[model samples]
Target: MTLIYALEIIGTFVFAISGLRLAAKKHMDLFGATVIAFVTAVGGGTTRDVLLGAYPVAWVQDTVYPVVILLAVPFTFIFRKYIVNLKRTFFIFDTIGIALFTISGMQKALSLGIHPGLAIVMGMVSAVVGGVIRDILCNEIPLIFRKEIYATACLAGAFAFFLLDYYTTLSENIIYLITTAIIIIIRVVSIKYDLSMPKMKG
Candidate 1:
């Protein structure tokens, strides 16, 4: 596989593991955990494909992503005890995964010659939808709604990517890296400092 594809695969697998671990913490059984992992890993890509008319979605066509997520489940199960209190670490990895996924989604849409604004939305969908589905399955408020700057981080990265592509001579990979880093920083720093969206007054 190409390097980019490999990075995406790793990102997907990590996100799936994080999802599976979360499911286990909620005492979900094997079937539920697997379902959560599978959906978390590919939900974003599925949405992106549907919106892009890419048909059948990517994970539907390739067994690789699904298989990777499947393998991740057991490892999570085996290590669940030692990692039970790793919420912060999970957030870090999950945030990074979405950051990269957001950039990748926007890049895919851009490469397809989609409009920039639409591409940004697609990027947000690609990063946020997967986690949203996972949270719904777990009967929790989606991370986007709860804390740690979730969707905001993804949107910020997506916009950063778009602007970098538009107004800079930066290489494509560099743009992705910068955008991902910005999202990661926002997410991590917010978590560290308790920063968040403001509450609206009635």
Candidate 2:
């Protein structure tokens, strides 16, 4: 499979796990957990595609997307105990998933001749909308709206990808790697330092 395609599958699986992790915490049934996983896996990309007027959306275009989520959700649900114990691992997966999706989304928009500025917005949307939907469904505040550096990390990563693609003569593969690394680092560091955007006084 192409690198981008593989990234998409991996991102789907990781994001699905994140959603299922929350469902497990909420005592959701297997069916409900799987539903949340499915939504988390494809919600952002579906939104991005629809906004871009891309036909059939991504999951419909590639059966592998849904198939990966299908398999991943059950695996996650079955290993809830073990996975839940590894909070750091799950957070890493979440970081990597968002980073991958951000670059993939921007690449798609750029391929369609979209302007870099708007493509960056599309990238952020593709990265975070799933988590937003998942949180809303779980009756929790979405991460983007919270003090978490989630969406900002995505936006910064998208901008990095755009700059590297346009300014540097680096290969696309290298660009993708650097952009993803930047995002992962930003997210991990933010979490490590308890960094957050300022909020209004209560």
- Which candidate number has the best lDDT? 2
* Candidate 2: segments with Cα more than 4 A from true spot: 200-202
Question: In angstroms, how far off is 168's CA in candidate 2?
Answer: 0.9
Candidate lDDT scores, in order, read 0.84, 0.90
Q: What tens digits encode model 1's per-residue C-alpha lDDT throughout 1-202?
A: 6545765787798789878888878998899889988899899989998989977688888899888998997778787765557776677678878887888888878989999999999999888899899989898988788745678888888888888899999987677678888988988888888888877779
> How well does candidate 2 match the true structure in TM-score terms?
0.95
lDDT of 2 by residue, 1-202 (tens): 7788888889999999998899988999989999999999899999999999998898998888888988987687688677767988888989999999999999999999999999999998899999999999999999789877888888999999988998999999889889999999999999889999878899
Candidate 1 all-Cα RMSD: 1.5
TM-scores, all candidates, are: 0.93, 0.95
Model 1 vs. true fold: TM = 0.93
Residue pairs whose backbone atoms clash in candidate 1: none
